[model samples]
Every structure is written in C-alpha cells, then in structure tokens.
Target: QEGVKRWLNGRDDAAFSRWQLSRQREGQFIDLLLAVRDELDRLYRQPLDEPSMGQRKARLFEQLRERYQQLKQQWGGYAGFDGWFSHDLNNAYLASIATYEAWVPAFQQLLKQAGGDLAGFYAASRALGELPSPQREQRLQALLQAADP
Candidate 1:
C-alpha cells in the first residue's frame, strides 16, 4: 500500500486508469510516466522567443525533437514486455514518434516558405490539429476495472 500510494503520485484513485491491480507491485511504470510528463512540461513551458522562422526552426524544433527523443527512450525499454502498461507506452511512443517524424520535415518546409512569419508556421501547423487517441489507450481502459476493496 505504501508503494501504491507513492505510485499514485498523490492521486486518490490510485488506478492507472487502465488496470485494476489485484496487488500493487513495483511502480516503475507510473514513475516513468511521471518522468515523461515532467520532461514534457519542462520543455513545453520554455518560451520560444525565436523571432524568425529560421530561428524557430533551428531552436524550437530542436527542443521539440529533444522531447520526443526523451519519450522514445522512456518507452523503448518496455515496448514488447507483454503487459498492459508496456503495451500502452510502446503504442504511444510509436504513434508520437511517427507523427513527429513526419512533422519535422513538414515544419522545415513550412519554415522555409513562411517568409520569417510565425503566423504562417502556426497556420500550417494548426492544419495538423489534434490526433485521435491511440487504440491501445482504449484497450487498456477496458482492461481496467475497479480493484477489489
């Protein structure tokens, strides 16, 4: 219970939102998620003050790529480990990596044509919008139910 409490990261639910554990074991998976979240928040909070598209391309995207790389590393270890958490993380990693891989080139091209206009980059990037949640998340949710009280 002590470990699970820590794993919950102070959440009352204690559920992974994707599993109803009969017993709590090592909370490495949740810890990894927290690490990923912290890193993302760290990177996202940085103000991208690059005034020119070239600068934005060089600096902002470098940071973005770095975040993705961090995620890739986080998910890589558990990709095929044959559990719901591993499955979910790996799926997230794969989808996010693929989408970002495509977007890097897209952003580069957009920056080239953006004529130093951040709005142009914004307009073009906004076209990509939000991607649908990966199927694995749903599967994991279904797999999770109320834990035995």
Candidate 2:
C-alpha cells in the first residue's frame, strides 16, 4: 500500500516515470483511434443509414481502410500500430477510453476528499476495496457523480 501510495503521488522513482511515459503513449494511441473513428463517422454517416445493413457495414469498412491508410501516411508510414485497425481492437480502445474518462476524475475526487493526504487516501481506497462488489460499484458511482461539475 505504501508503494502504491508513492507511485500514485508521483514520487521520484524510475519505474514510476517509465509507467507514466507508457500511459502517455497509450493516450496518444487512444487519440489516434478517436481521430480515425471521428473521420470515419464524418465521411460515412450517410452510407451508414443505407437500408441494407450489410452494405452499410461494407461502406464503413471501406472508409475505415481509406482513413487508416491516410493515418499511416500522416504518421510517416509507421506500421507498428497496424494491429489496432481492426473492429475488435477499435471497440476495446473505445472501452478503455470510456473507463479512463470515467475513473480519473473519480480518483481525483477521492484524493481531494482525503485533503491531499496520501495515507488518508490509501486508507480510504482500502476501505472501498474491502466493500462487497455491488457496494463498491455504488461507491465508485457516487464518487463519479460527486466529481462531476
């Protein structure tokens, strides 16, 4: 718990810095996926409404392919992200984005509730973790709601 508190508070640790860098890279990847999804939506919105679901899906895929190629070229032909262009991967990426968007603010609120005290924050976090699954989720939801402006 102490180690986690240190890491969470951004203490001077090489591994923590590396973890932060990896998170930043993940954020960049999420941004790229979002851009691709947005462009595809803008380009293929009309086609997506076609009566034939199969045709609409085909059109969507076609646009995705075009946009992906453009993205690759924009990134100076970096193919390391080729695996992220799939339908399943895109869904997973979106889910991850949603989770991050929801949880970060809630955690921030929890920290604020602790008055920036790391020990208090850890104790509060442990209390939350010890709750039953449903209760834990309810508490998390409450935190999220409280964090909302």
Candidate 3:
C-alpha cells in the first residue's frame, strides 16, 4: 500500500511538472504572437495612400522575416513559423490581440488564487483540466467571475 501511494504521488508530481512546462511554453507562444501582432499593426497603421507605403510594408515584412529566422535558429530549427506570416496579416493580428486580451486577466486571477505560487497554480490548472467537459467549463466560468474586480 505504501509503495502504491508513493507511485501515485510520483505520477501526480510528474503530471504537475508537465502542466508547469506547458504553461511556460504557452507564455512563450503568447510573447511571440504579440511580437508578430505589433509588427503587423505597425504596417497596417500606415496610410495606404502614403507615397512610400509599399516600400515601408516591404521593409517591415523583411524585418519580421529576419526575426522569424532568428527565432527558428534559437529554437533549434523549429518550423512553427513556416506559414505563420503567410496568412492574412490583419486576421493574424486580430487573433493574436484577442488571445492576449483574453488570457492575461484569467492568468492573473489564477496566480492570485494560488497566492503567487506557480506550482500551486499548475496543480489547480491540472485539476480543472481533469474535470468533465461541462464541469470544466463551469469551473472556468466561476474562476472568471471571481477574477472580475
């Protein structure tokens, strides 16, 4: 019985660690997404009728492409960005901005609930994820409600 308890505890610990790592990766993704969004916004905000608009857009795209190539090198040849910039830039910017706007407040609330304990936040997130779909949605809604100032 003691051995079984130990094994279960070990499993739970591993799962918690995975969740923590997942959250870290998610934060990285959000950071990259925001950077891309900002670059696209800078291009979009320029007047279409500006004399050098095409040139400016081309310069911005080249800059963004260089950044993406650097990121790929940093990430050990990760191809995640291969088609990221090929899509409609405005749609991509809107989606990224929407994700950031929606994610930050909920993450803050989770941190608050955990009293700033990252491990505790991961455990809570794992628990919520383990619930049935309906229950998970309900719990998420409650958390969002509590998050409201």
RMSD of each: 19.6, 5.7, 8.9
| Model 2, span 29-133: residue lDDT tens | 656556545654554555444456445545655665676677567656756567755544444455566666667777777888998787898899899999999
Please report, as a residue range, the 10-residue window in candidate 1 with the lowest summed lDDT.
140-149
User: Clashing residue pairs, candidate 2?
Assistant: none
Task: Please give the distance, in angstroms, between residue 132's alpha carbon in candidate 2 and its true position after superposition.
Answer: 1.5
Off by over 4 Å in 1: 1-88, 127-149
TM-score of each: 0.25, 0.50, 0.45
lDDT of 3 by residue, 25-48 (tens): 545655666665676667778667
Give the per-residue Cα lDDT of candidate 1 at 31: 39
Deviation from native of the Cα of residue 115 in model 2, angstroms: 0.6
Who is ahead in TM-score, 1 or 3? 3
Full-model lDDT for every candidate: 0.44, 0.66, 0.66
lDDT of 1 by residue, 1-149 (tens): 32344467447564643333423222443334444544544544677554653454345434544554454466553333234333324324634644543334445554445664666857744653442456533422332322111
